[model samples]
Target chain A: MLAVGLLGLILLSVIALFHSLLASTSKSNDMTVATAMAQQRLNELVTQQPSYRATYGQDFPTDVLGQAVYAHDSQSTSTFYSQARPELLKDDGPAFGRTYYLEVQVFWNTPDANQVAANRHQQGAQSVKAGRVVYVPGS
Target chain B: MKRGFSLLELCVSLGILSFVLLGIFGVFELGQSSFHFASLRQGLQSEARVAFYALGNDLRHSSFVTVTTVPRTVSVILPRQESRGNQTLDRDGLCTAGVENWESPGAIDIHSGFPNFDSFVVYYGTSEPEGRLIRQVVRPALVGPYPNAEFSLVNSMHDNPLANSSRVGVTRTLSKRLLSFRARRDNDSRLVVVLLRLRGMGGAKPGTGARADETFELTLKTYPENTYPRV
Candidate 1:
């Protein structure tokens, strides 16, 4: 009887350790994918040359494991000055420029059904964000 | 009367127990190593992302780019009005007063004889095995003779800034842990490709057999959005 009890205890401990390891590995993999997706989306936005738009639509054509999606938005402002700074005036030209603020968010489905349901209203599951600022010539 | 297990049986049980415990410990060690490797890889990826983001942002807005092979430098001419900050300062570290307020949309009339650009250069420097990616922004003391003059100034700085004390710019360290850095411009597409290789610092202890030399490489291709029209 004692031998049987000891064997059972060892089996339970091994099973618990295996379960924890699997969980950790899965979480790490999810995070890695999320971060990569966020970076990719941010790069796309930077390359597109931000337009003077208040908000951008949430559309990511690439699908990650059929579970991850990405969305982006931008804020832009154009500032114009009546008088050019004298020091900057070489040919005494007028001055103007535009600034763009961009934010990208990537969302992925979580494995836990309960957690997914709880966060469904907040955008399905887990998410990661990347933001950037860009300046462009304006008139 | 029944007696306890014989000596042979006791010896066999002890041998089996030792083997099982050893197997369990081996599995635990393997798991630990894998977790450490994953964490290290994640850190490296995050660092590379930040470095690329900074480099790409500046390169994309540049109006002219000159890539030199010998020192692996990418010099760009960025419109002064489009630069991040409102004020432009000279080598004296003092802001140029009236120039700061200039603002215009679309491309500046470079052909119309307007002084409208700043010089920015990105290069790799510092000690090997642990180098740094540095970005230097040089705001000219005087406007006009620009675009062309700016290019020459940036090239000079890239070759050797220390030789000339009058060089005006702010040096910023973009990232560290660099094992190798290279940049080249594609002749056909006019896109700039930057290669960065980094290695992990590894474990603090000298001989714990921990992973101390993992390396990662990243290749970034960027298109300059505002290159000047070549006549």
Candidate 2:
């Protein structure tokens, strides 16, 4: 009986280690997706310029570049996030055109919604976000 | 009398030990395979990352850009921000024509009011013998043209890259193992949306049910931060 118990514990530990490895791989994949999606959104806003005012909380295309990429965890009621204020960060130059801040917050989660909710209390606290301030060519 | 276990009891214990050992070995093998798959996936991701960095650096300061979707080619015309040896030039032909208007310390830039000068760069995807590839061509300025003496080497390489692509400057290979390269652009924003997918050569990992052809994809959108409205 003692031998069985000891071997069972060892097996459980190995399984746990295996589980964590899988989690790490999944996290890495999510990170790549998040950064790329964030970059895409920033690109669209800076490039489109005029239409950016309306897409403050929009999600960029995902997967193959024009598809949705995630399911929000249940604690996060909405996948949308507000953009930071334009004047939040200052990088204006006397000669460079008036600059504005651009930000994209990517909210994604595993399909299992409740797994992380018990630990995370804040909305978007578990998400990956990327932001950049764009310089207008000339005023 | 000191007596050890009977032969039958010893055999049963050995059998149990063998089963436990087998289980342990099985777990170890699973771990080894997982590590292999993860490493291959990371390798593919890093290749995509290299392309992303190169594209971002070239696209950010572009004064003009053109994109062709079918072959996934992007052409960018950037202001000559760096000095060539001792000569600095721009649309105003500062060093060439002896002008004094540019305010930046030593560099003459388009923003200082020269709109139509500087060379362009081209990045396109192709299928080569090794694998699908993304390549770049560094074309010289069509308008003001660099000092003739300074660019003769590159000019010759560009004219005949078949014999000179490896010497650098004229052409470059960005990434390989490319499964797909797609770029979408519009006239209004002139933003280029780039979708890149690369496949790994490794076979599928056991017990994972994953396909042998491991693919990684990266998507990006970019625009010339400095391009001007058509006059």
Candidate 3:
């Protein structure tokens, strides 16, 4: 009877470890994806500086930054969202020939709270944990 | 006699094990699919970025070539033309499009002394699936005389095609789909604004279908000789 109990415990531990590994990898993938999406939105806005400067008088328009949602989950869409915001501007004070900005502040979401909790519980059965990562664009 | 295990108990245990394995496999497959899509989305996004930058560079340095002062014709000037820029377009050979030269390499001819200038029109319609095709018409500055006869420098992003708009048609295939196209001038009134939109390849929709409408916008800034700061 003791041997059977030991074998059952071992099997449960193996299952828990496997689940932990999968959850951690999924989180890692999500972080990478979110970061890339944020950067792309910022680049598109900044590259069009010349045109915007000519039309809107060199001031970075905050209202122009738009939001997008990405479906990344399975069985249901995993929602990944991002938006662009200006951080700095170098205008000529109305006399310069060109304008530049140190635009920043793009953010995106990771997986959902409930989803992460449930996934963590599944791994915790064998003392495994999910890996969470965050990325700030410049730093 | 030896006792045997009950069929019901055996079946129940087998069913539970199968269920556990199925759940694990299901999650694994889902994770794999998500990863693949994430990579594909990233690739398409990057390609779209490169396309935008390419168009933006050309637009920022756009120069207008003058073909005629009486009936002004303008051509977008490029730093250099590609060798394969020439393209012969024949849709049953009924209609033909070709290049028309300007008065000089970077001259802007005027029509009746007005600001009216010539432009290259690129036509984009549904033809290829999940691919972009562009056709540009190069109109010369003059019609006849020694100054005319289609200038020797045949310019194009693609190769130079037949000059005869009546003979072999002229068409240029762009690197991608032309999304939103627009041009305007700055407060100086001579500086020009050109906005170009290019479609992304390998998108969820490659053609003008339900999901293939992914596009990138590029903006370019330019100035006429009169508006440019003199060196």
In model 2, what lDDT does residue A69 have?
Answer: 35
- Model 3 lDDT per residue over A43-87, tens place: 444434445545765334444232333222312334443333443
Error of 3 at A29 (Å): 13
For residues B67-175, could you state the per-residue lDDT of candidate 3 as single tens digits? 1111111232211223435322111100112224445543333433322223333333212222343444545554333233543222222223433242223454444
Error in Å for residue B79 of model 3: 39
What value of lDDT does candidate 1 attain over all alpha carbons?
0.46
Ranking by TM-score: 2, 1, 3
Clashes of 3: 28
For each candidate in turn, the TM-score is 0.46, 0.62, 0.38
Clashing pairs in 2: none
Docking class of predicted structure 2: incorrect
Name the lDDT of candidate 3.
Answer: 0.37
**Which candidate leads in TM-score?**
2
> How would you encode candidate 2's per-residue C-alpha lDDT over B90-116 as one tens digit per residue?
100001111122343433444554433
How do the residues B24-56 of candidate 1 rate in per-residue lDDT, one tens digit apiece? 665566556545555655666566667767766
Of the true interface contacts, each candidate retains a share of 0.01, 0.34, 0.00
The candidates, ranked best first by lDDT, are 2, 1, 3
The candidate maximizing lDDT is 2
Could you say which candidate leads in DockQ?
2
